[model samples]
Target: MRESYSLLPITELKGVGARLAEELEQLGIATVDDLFAYFPYRYDNYELRDLTDVQDQEQVTILGKVQSEPLLNYYGKKKSRLTVRVLSGRYLITVILFNRPYLKRSLKLEDTVTVTGKWDRNRATLTSSDFHIGQPDQNAQWAPVYPVKSGVSVKKLRVLISQAFTQFPNRIKENLPKELLTSYKLIGREQAIRTIHFPDGQANLHQARRRLVYEEFLIYQLKMQAYKRMKRSSSDGIRIPLDQKRIREFVGLLPFSMTHAQNRVIDEILKDMASSSPMNRLLQGDVGSGKTIVAAIALYAAVSAGYQGALMAPTEILAEQHAENLHNLFQPFSISVGLLTGSVRGKKRRELLENLSNGKVHILIGTHALIQPEVVFQNLGLVVTDEQHRFGVGQRGALRLKGKEPDVLYMTATPIPRTLALSVFGDMDVSTIDELPGGRKQIKTYWVQENIIDRVIQFMKKELDQGRQAYVICPLIEESEQLDVQNALDVHAQLSQALPGYTVALMHGKLTPEEKDEVMNSFKKRDDQVLVSTTVVEVGVNVPNASLMIIYDADRFGLSQLHQLRGRVGRGNAQSYCILLSDAKSETSREKMRMMTETTDGFKLSAYDLKLRGPGDFFGKKQSGLPSFKLADIVHDYRTLATARDDAARLVQSPQFWQEDRYEQLRKPLIESGLTQTLHLD
Candidate 1:
């Protein structure tokens, strides 16, 4: 019954003919409720101003009579500009337009017109892209400006939104219980939508945004709590008891002492694995943190209990590195490690698969190929996914299904804020390794402008002359169909031409698995070489001697990716440096550069990145398994998010919300509006 309005197609509304219906379809608005959910991206304040009071270079709106007919001037075949001279009593102002010749017909001599644009004193003209034929609207506070496609106009959307509201004024239903809204001081869903689309003033808009943010966050928190409950009460898991003797030998082989942070996280993982319920834990450590050693400890304990362990990485290169490192870690303890990826072929692949199925291989490390259907496990009791954000929920689940609900440990180098951790990964037990291994030095980072490019190159040359390796990271961007981004290929060519004696290697997503492995291996061996690549090198390329890290157009990278790229360099004991080259003149871009230079703390950087860029950019599309909320900015409304999470945890704890028939209606609506089914939380 609650889905009736949302079920109706947008074509049923008035003024939505076939042509308009096709236009709306392009925006993913096929239903009546979809049109309503299309909120404004910004607002336009229509403040009326007197012509005499207009200041220089100010965006103002003035009403006056047209003194002369509009004149159109042309530069070339398709180039033109418009001018309309206006007079308000004794004051006079010339209005200029850039490309809108269509507005020429709307002007009539001596007709009162309202012009809204920037006022320039030097030219004594107002540069306007917007003007109308009506008198100035003194009472009009603001207007909703929505995002539109090619065929749709802002005026057309305004008309359609009004029609939708008129047709379904009272039909727009609220999903939250009335008491919940009253207790939390949140407005009803219908009122929130109305005020958001057609806000009366700033205060009303603020209230409208508050209500929507709460709703978006609440839905996400509910899913988190639901998954948490499932993990706790269910017993379909293998209990891997702690092995003190085996663990002692495993850590004894390490070259350095373990940090207190690492020890604490290992204990948490051990507790979860020893339980009856399945263990879904997230282990996050800063770059070079001893997360790998902790994971090895868990694998060792799992193997001691006669259970096979599988570790999945996002990239083939990373998978290979893990196999090598893990093999070394378990060599003295006589634990066998197998490597499986798409690159393995013919007899080698068959041998690994047979060994894995027959329980000969104690631990398996590979890329997404580990989740394939034919990859059977003998006694897979534990599945550890490194950099878990790189895989989707389905990929993680497929690996777990190899053995009935194997205990899952998700590891990541990307650090997020604690509030965000509580909101997004609430379903999983979280453990953090904040301390780096002893003897590692903090990376010296600098944000360089383009004018000093030559000087920066010389510094890198000095590093190379000193027998140290360096990494030059290119920006990853795709602006439009007609424009190609400056990717690794272009940068590699330029760098090869600029640096004569040094060997420069190229690697990116377009390279084949064998090609990437070959290039990475070559880069690792050559001390005088520089690897010019993209973010593909962010995770797996770990050469300790590689001390210099330079990212071109560094402003294009988010704080997290930039931090991960920096992590690639400082993995060794030698003093390291990260240089960011950005010529961007924007304040936001410069601010990010400043933040990078000030600190190397991933947690603090992530929290700042959340505030600088919204949650969408923080988790991108394919990575970070989290589906972004449409309206919730994790930075601004953090307090609201905390409240929502607490309320959801409380509500889902008791059986009354799920068992009572009255509250069942509320649960279904909220779940359906979000990506509950996509993440397999259900």
Candidate 2:
């Protein structure tokens, strides 16, 4: 029964008909079990409050008698406002309702009703968007609000949930073992699921939340542990020997001296590459922190050992940049660098593949096209990826399989907090290049109102007058292309009108690749003194002379994206500044702006972002190509994650644990969740 629980359709439940089921389906509730998984995003405290204790702007539930008949006032063609003057002892407060004329039938003179809303001090009225036709204490202690669609009403959803719980009492089975539940001080899984939708009391709701959070985190930790074990026990990796003298010569000839952090990370990678076991290392660094330099060292090591190395980038532009950078770095040592991407085709691609397979080409850099079946390496020793999060775990695995025991290294400019690192990249060793090279000036940042456009333009002109380039990032707002194109054109027109003497150009994703390249190159060469572009510039368009960045509609972008955009500047020696222009007045937007201006540390901001927006918003919902966890939240469930990680490690060590009957209920869910794919143990 528990194994096939999710297969039971919502239509089978009482009070849920075909039409109602269709409405519920809009919220992704097709099965009876999906309703259980759809936990409340927040709870409304409908607990009754005394009239005397109510403060201005406080949401409270007041039980009062209507002093006079409810008057319905009509204004515009489709608009109506209902005013009910309610009396509670000696105090009188008006209940204002918008577009709800039907309430006049239920609420009459002397009718007692419960009102829950915010008290408006200026109007001295209780504006209620939600109310109940009952005594206050008779209602549920806590009102759970599920994520709703446009047509679905909260009252109807609550009724359906109550019916499902009542009719399917014994159908829900307890999943966790009794010993495990007792040890963790958790309630039964069946009770937790029931309480989550409609809690008997506050204590049960907290207990239920704790149980579900632990379950989600434990399964994730187990998957990570199994992946780690498989890599250690796998026999396909080829060990590459590191020569100290060869490395010293390569480092000595470089134009700029390597920072201590870069050198330390290189040393760590060298040690990992030298080991017989396959290397899974994540290289994290802030923008312009020399991550590419560390990756270059590993590629050289692979080539020096008579092996081929592959570097994959998220976009063709980045791939081209890496190809150019690596070619310049390796040409001094006579190592051939080849660029392979989806665009490289026909005879040219065929020749590159042949050269790559025959050991003639020492290094290959490209986009996802490098993972194609036809592209084989003679002695592939290292696999490196820039913008590693862009590729899913499956894509990374596919690349890792290309060579025997090849070392896998990933580099990212977006700093990931350590807590997230342990959950997402738990299978890999972590390396961080946290320091900038000596004498690099800190980029000053500011968050300003949209009205300060003239001042920002004046600042950009001052920078351009000194022959420095500036980037005005036009947000590629998640809207229609016509709107985005119009925004770019509008901003371009404004900047051009403002700074009439300077050259201004526009770029966006809608532009052809050739057009984008042309515009980027023009900006890079200072032909276009100021370039206005969308977030496409966030990846790898490095122009050191560009010291000014103006982000329009800054509130629309996430903290991580804003950080990456800020990184575009501050690459050169001159002091740089980022101007974040936004008119959004929400608290969340204000907090994001405040954090951006307060600090320049990417890691600190990353941790703050994780807490502010949870894992999904910090990265995307499809982060690292990882699927969404149905129940766990990385920010709120950190302690549970830590415990789960330790428990998973210990559980895998117990060879007899999997053979026991106590964990029988966990098998189907774990397999269906895809956690078992990472676990190689039969």
Candidate 3:
């Protein structure tokens, strides 16, 4: 039978059998292509070294003769050791392998072998546990380190990978044009793959990385360009011609005057509404920047023009919050409003659908459930999405499809850097709400040590005694039973004991949705004097009466998260405070914590975070399902990404490239990588 590329089991390879194939499959290596893309996380260099040149603490491979038989020693109930002596003519050194008496039988006195490991020096004597004895010139030079699981060793995986690479067919097509390679001074694909696996030198590795990084970013830029072109060509809903009088009247009725930044963004959105094409825009602002009010004005414009509008939030609580806020704001204007979410069921949901279909609901607010097939709109004109980063591009597209080519306004509270915004959201027009609403007080933030817990509690009690509310945030829901930090349940217990007179309520993810809602509702009504909870309350549970927020283990959270938590307080007329508690002693950790104390500006905090911890660490691995780039450091390589974006725009503008066969191979890898999904193309 002819061997198939995928149908043949992995055991068909030289050293693999059914059992080994199953083991390889457990590592997500089922086919040749999967193995090829599974790049090493890091490499260990094992270049040969002479015995005379072996230095302490340096990882080296040296060949020496065993001068004495290994000796075994046992000192404690659980401790055992094996000691071997190695000699190189005039010099001698003792090699100690701890807790492995079997090594005494594995090696003979006169045996000559090569050992690979790092040499350690203690009181002028060198020692190392990171050593492995092997035959000279047979072991790997630059060993690839894979993330090992149970029953797997780095050495064993290295052997398997080396064998796989040898037997695997070189089927990768050259996707980058030769001209671009020459212009960018990038290595070829074949060279990059080989050098990345077994680099001859640091310079070669760097060159390989540069080529790969550029390719990754280049594809991303290409997709953005395609999306931009596609959006420009798509048909738009009827433009709601701007009515300055109506807008001004709405602005006059607002409780506070619009900030200069808010007015600018409003003007930008108005211009988009009056344009010939649908608006694909993003409204980025810090927490409490009044983006909702601006969205309301846009919705009013759409409704006044005899069209409908919709707003989508990431969570049901946030969606409900938006609906309530909009309903209250539009109440005086007599504008109809409706709310729909997954939790809304039975007759209410059916009635909402009927109202939305009949255009009785001028503005609609809901979670992703609003995009369901049953929910349809009459002449939907504008779509606004809150916390846009929380939803994927596909989800946004699904929501947009609810309307007839409706204008889109995506909003994010997390302030993305200008460079990153350009790279990530390049296809969309960007507007930032850089100003806070008038009369809004800046939150006073402080970092405290654990020893100040009593003082903090006393302050909270004082606030509660004054008829104000407070929120105490814990990192975990239940007591971990193992970890030393406070949890929601434990904090609730302690606080209940500490403040016997105040009513304390606890909420966490472990609670059922109904239970969570009950707790949140009780806290919102100020029925509970103190609310102790986990990060479940992080996004959209607003309690204007809550004047203080105390977050334990504040060092465990990212800067953006810290800012979001701080935003939970300082929403009402009260002078609010946020206390961050941490036990960290490192200066870096202190400085990171201090960023919150120094500023309440989300953008400024993000900038500081980007500097302190690079973008990769800020979001962490598997952050929101963003594509992980093997080569590009989004923080450090901003200039390169910008250049790539510009180049992609220019290249895509050439109709010949999009129409010609020349770019087919160039676009194939991008499609295969699943990065093109963001572009809304097949």
Candidate 4:
């Protein structure tokens, strides 16, 4: 009989009724498959904790008798409390529950129950809000802690998980190849799944985690190999031969000469453009490295050859900024330019779309809207996506499919470490613009304590008096009553009050799109002397006159993010400064802050970040769209990854392996597990 893995409704499960099904849906468990695939974030081992030899302040589980009924006590206006005495025959411990009077009735006196909680050293007690009254065997020896949502308790979820595992079809397929499993000494899939959820010991859990991590990495390598194969086999649509005369003319139009690094990168791109194979290259540079000018030169060359070119940015503000810069640069050459973004209204958008389709607009710039179904290019020869890491392979594929296999150039201001770049962008060629443009002043960075706020404000006021603008960035948008970090609103209020004579405007994500645009526009025009905002201004919005950037709670942000925020300033000729305010006094924070002072090179900073925080922290799922693995640290296990990559390459090279039934069995589960989704293989 063939095994069936249908997406049955969660309500079909025994314990999941209508209300509980909705709750499970909130946790993203809509089907049996989803529940099965929902891996734990981490595991806890209660098997090592014993009632007889439990130490104070140690996390332990104890099976004891509730010698006394729970009692509720209230002290003045404080929250209500419940206390119960339990005896394990070896010792006695008081269990305190805060503001939970109902727990008193739930556990009656003389009840034998198993309670798992962390012991308190100061009070010599075990106070736990997570404790439950249940049979000893009912509690998991090794528990899986999932990423939980509101209204869901870990104990209840554990019960539901056990029930699900028992009812799971026992004929689950083993996806890993027999040779590979034997080589890695990994356990069978069925046993690994069971052990991962409820392991008998720590060794089994570790083995299960290692197998899963290896599987995740293996699938990732395979998908990347497939993408590479596809790219190699595709036909090149258009090849724009590089012309020195045209390049010289474009360079002559620029007021400042190109940096040697910029020139070299452009030369590399030109060579790719001239080749018969389509270009799949990444152009990485630091902020103010003059990447945009180099891209414009390439686009101009493509347009000069009677073809269309498009540039896609992650944000609408960036797209608009690109359009404005390109319009000014290409106006003398009479190269028609147009902007397409979500903000473009009815008739104007329709007209732009028509112009783009008919080749009336030689170059187009926009956000994700540029990849819409209606948008088309008459003869697109090249496509450049800025901030390439911010986009996924699937989105890039959608843009590339717009034209007849146009050459692609991905750009990013945040430099990626060499190892990470090789792993992430293995299929594509890469170029780096290592130098900043001439006449651009270096941004002097500083790390200051909160006590130096007055001095920073004084410096900002001095800059405002000099007809220059400033940016004060906060980590949060609104004032949270609980968080200790200073929010944009609070900072705006404080700055506005401190500098009453100067113009100060506040901007945050909570504001409407139009409202955000209005504030940004005002800031650009220098009507606002000081713009206090969140990280929304991290990219795209440019003010050449803004010379001061003050980042509050800068230690909370990653190194790459902080670099981008600092890039917002130093676009002008006047000397610029980036002040990083942090309360952290730890060695890690000090080292990170020191990086800002050492150099403005984003590539170096990224490499440092990777070493400090590891690859998982460098490119989180929110930004890179890659699956977070269990055992593979992209930094630590780089050698293993290389071995896997080579092994995958060798496997694909054998024609007989591709046709093998075993290969299908190995590949199918990987596709179903979402690793293929990362590489857009399906």
Candidate 5:
């Protein structure tokens, strides 16, 4: 019976036509099942209370008698205020409602009324959020409020959902096993959905919400666990023996010593490579922590085993940088490295493709161009992707498809919070380089206002005079009328005029790839004293001599991004400083500035960022393949998530768990929702 509802579209509901269907689709509701799943974002309680029991500014509902006639007053264009004096107990409260002039006609002197709104005690005013001509029914006190768009009113949604419940009676079957549901003390699926939309009271609301949240988390965790198992048994992975002698020689060839953290991570990667199952791991390290060298060693291990390697980066600049570094590192061993980007075209591109296909190129590094149709490898064994969040799951999966079950390594500079890792990248094993290399001093950070801009410029001039380059970063490329913040162009112009002889170069997203490279090269060679840019220099553009980073309107950027920008400096041995320029008056902005100066730990900053922005805005966009949960919050509902994960792990390992009748309802989502088809879940 529940399966039948999945096939019924929203148009089947009364009063829902083509236009209304399109509006409902905007809220992710296409079918009757979807409408049932669209839970309310919040609930408004209108339980009646006495005037004496109400606190100042509390949203309260009180039954009263109108003491005077409702006075209607017209104000500014199309605006009106309706005021009525209501007597409740010993107090006479003024019930004020805005833009509700029609209410004045129905309200008469000495009439019984019920009003729900904010109570201002000092002024004896009840600013009406909602009102009833008489006492409202007890069951209608708790009103569910959904997130809606224009032309789709909350009243209309309530009507549609109520009709769905009446038309499809007892059709929502339970998806969880009987034993599991009883153990967890969860309500039935149908009751949970019904109570969540038209909740009876606080207790039932909590119970219903808990059931829905647990179910969402459980399904997501099951998907992840199934995907992980599929990767492990999908095919036989390349069992490459660890070449200790070659790795040791490469390490010895380097001018600097590897940190314990880097060495430990390398050991983990090598272990995964030597296993029969393919390696699906995420490598996390702060900027300039020698992650590249660790990746280099892994690439070396694959190439020495007579299989090709590929490193995919989000941008061409990072890819080219890896190409140059890998070419230099592998030159002593006589292993060839090839670079393929969008600019590498015509005959050169053809030659590179031929070399990669025939095994002449031992290591191939490029951007998205590496995933094209013509690009093929002789024996691709390992894949490493830089800044894994920039690319969606499809992009990453596309690169993996290029090889025959290649061991994949995803590297990121932004440290994902542990809770987020469990939800987003839960399928992959995680390896973190917690320690920075020796001899690198911690970057000194400070937050300041725009009034002291001249002093900050003077400090930058001193750094420039010491033969150290600096970066002046802004949040925007050009001036924005909406936001009165500093931009790259204006900052570049101001810095040029402020400092007489220093060359202030500009870089932003508007520039061509070649132009960006040229400007970055000039700064790298100390030809430009100041490089003013946007967040484009946030990753992979490393200059060892740059000692100062001044971020304008720093409050506008998130904590993780600010940390990435700070990482641009402090690459060299000399003492580095990051001066954040902002005069934001909000407490949240001030807190962001304070935290930026408190610690340089990327993991700590990322956790705080996740807390401040939630998961939706944490990645600056909706991350691909990250579950869009309706009721479960990874940050707040972490304990519930952990429980769901544990339950799912146990269920997946159970023999014939998918085929059992007790688990039959669970298979509907896994199969009908395309989880089985996409991940090939058994």
Candidate 6:
């Protein structure tokens, strides 16, 4: 019976015809089981309350008697107003509803009813959102509100869900082991599925939600654990011999001193290098925090041990930057460094590939070109990916496969919150470089409206006149009708006209790699005093002489991105400045600007950004490898996530747990959720 119902189509349900079925399919509900799994985003608390106790604009439910008949009046086209007067205690409250004229029948005179909505204090009215003909029981006070589309209304979905419950009882099978259920004090899967929709009582709803959320997090953590296990097993962990004296010599050769944070992270990385298990670590540091030096140290260690090392970047310019910096750093030791990018073609590319394959290139750096089929490595021991979030898992995985159990280091300049890191990069151990190097002055940041442009230009001219360069970043390369923000071309033209004496150049993502490199080279050499570009220079175009950054439409970007752009400056000895230009009316946008002015802490800004824009949008959702759980939220349910991670680690260690009869139900869902491709579930 359960199997039959699980396969039952939406059309088989009474009153669900073709159009409604199409709408249901839009919500990813095709079969009965899918509908059962579709949980509500939130619930309306229609618990009974007093009219006098309601605050202004507060959603409250009042049990009252209808003092007057509901008057239905037509307003604009397809719009109707239904008004009624309800008597509760000694107060007569006007109940206003919109476009729900059919509800007039339920608001008859002298009838006791329950109304739920926002209370408008000025109008002395209760704008009713939902109502019941009679006072519902305590268990029925909470109403489920599912995420709906244009054609599928919440009321209709509720009816269909209720019908599904009645038609498909006992269809939900218990997937969790009895030990887990007892240990967590969780309800059964069948009860959870049933109560999550109708919600019999508050206690039952809490228990049901807990069970479902735990299951979602547990399964996600299990997938992460499985991937971690696959990563360890696929590579024969070759422990790199760590010579502390050689490493100290390399560090001593550097011109500058390393921060305590850098030293700590390097210690962690070296420890991982010496371990038999492959090093799967994420190196997260703020912009200009000297992540490159740490990566250079790790590469030095790998190469000194008679093995090749490769570093991958997201963009050609960033790749070139790494190659240039590493070339200068490794020159003392005579360690060969090679560059491979989209533009390095024909003879040069072939020669580079040959050197790479023959182990002549001790340290190789490039964009995605490094992961191509032909770029073979003779002894690829270490793999480093700069700005790792920009590359997808498959790209990184492909590069790792080129070597025999290479130690992999994923580096990101964008600071991620620790909890977010655990959820997204849970497969890898995380190391953070929290402190900036000594004597690096903080960039003075300011937010200004677009109206104060002349003053900002004067300040820019003063800074440029003193032999400093400036970076002007726009959100768009070309003019966008949909967005009111300034484009690169317009900003370039404006800046050129304003600063006629200074050499102003333009760069954007639309430009070719050679063109971008040419423009960047000009800027680096101080030939261009002002460089107008898009977010292309947000990553790794380092120019120490440039000290001023003016960002237009700063509110259009996330806080982390704005920080990254700001980081382009303040890399030199002199003090730097960043001016944010926005005429944003929203408080959220204004708050972002204010926060940027408040502190230079990237981790704090990232945590706030994670809350403002969820984990999916923090980085690109498709490439993040973070799961889209229906009931579990990684931010709010982090404790639950941690517990689930521990449980998953324990469960995965049990050999062939997927094949055991006790976990048969669990394994079916894991495969169905698309873990079979990554995990050896068989």
- The prediction achieving the highest TM-score against the true structure is 5
lDDT pick, better of 1 and 2: 1
Error of 6 at 325 (Å): 0.8
Per-residue lDDT tens digits for candidate 3, residues 1-682, read 0111223446656777777667777887776555555567787776766656666677666667888888899988978877778874455777766787777778887787666656654422335445555555543566677776756567777676567668764554566777788898888876787677667666888898888788878888887776676666555555777777987898998888888999999999999998867899989998989888899999998887788999999877788788888899989888898988877889988898998899888898988887788988988989999988777677888989987778999888888777677766777888998878878788889899999999999888888888899989899876676766778888899999999888999988877766877888888987888989888778867788889999998887778888998899998998999999898678877887888898888998887777777766654434343456766877778778877888787766765554445666665554554434334322
The CA lDDT of each predicted structure is 0.83, 0.82, 0.78, 0.80, 0.88, 0.87
Sorted on lDDT, best first, the list reads 5, 6, 1, 2, 4, 3
Task: Give per-residue CA lDDT, model 6, range 88-125, as digits (tens).
Answer: 77779899999998887766688998888899877879
The alpha-carbon root-mean-square deviation between model 1 and the true structure, to one decimal in Å, is: 5.0
Better of 1 and 4 by TM-score: 1
Q: Which is better, 5 or 6, measured by TM-score?
A: 5
lDDT of model 5 at position 536: 92
Q: Model 5: runs farther than 4 Å from truth? A: 1-32, 49-59, 71-82, 96-108, 118-127, 149-152, 159-169, 178-191, 200-204, 241-245, 673-682
Clashing pairs in 5: none
For all candidates, the clash counts are: 0, 3, 1, 0, 0, 0
Task: Estimate, for each residue in 1-682, the C-alpha lDDT of model 2 and write its tens digit.
Answer: 1233348999999878888888889999999888777788778887778867888899888888988788999998989999989986667989998899998888767888888889876676998967767677544768888878867788678888888778887767666677779899998887888777777577878899999888888777766776676567656567787777898898888889999999999999999888887889899998778999889988998888877899999988789889998998888799999999777889999999999999999999999888889989998899998989888777888887889778999888878765567787777778999898888888899999988788888888899989899988876633465543226677887788888778998888887767777888888888899988888889967899999999988888888789999999988888999999987679999998998999888887887777877776666666564436766777677778888888878776565445566765655555565444334464
Q: TM-score of predicted model 6?
A: 0.85
C-alpha lDDT of residue 436 in model 4: 78
Candidate 4: tens digits of C-alpha lDDT, residues 467-492:
99999999998767776799988898
Ranking by TM-score: 5, 6, 1, 2, 3, 4
Q: Report the C-alpha lDDT of model 5 over 1-682, residue by residue, as the tens digit.
A: 2232247889988888999999999998999888999988998998888888888999998889999988899988999999999998889989999999888888888888989999999999999999878877787789989999968999899999999999888767788888878998999999999999998888998999899999999988887877777667677888987788987888888889999999999999999999988999999888777788999999999998888999999987889889998998899899999999888889999999998999999999999998999999999999999999999788899999888889999999988665567777889888988888988899999999999999999999999899999999999998899999999999898889999988999999998888988998898888898999999988857798999999999999999999999999888789999999999799999999999999999988988898899887886455446678888888778788888888888877665666567877765665655445323344
lDDT of 6 at 286: 91
Model 5 deviation from the true structure expressed as Cα RMSD, one decimal place: 3.5
lDDT of 1: 0.83
Model 1 agreement with the true structure over 228-315: per-residue lDDT tens digits: 6656654467777777776787787788888999999988998888887789999998888878889988999999888999999999
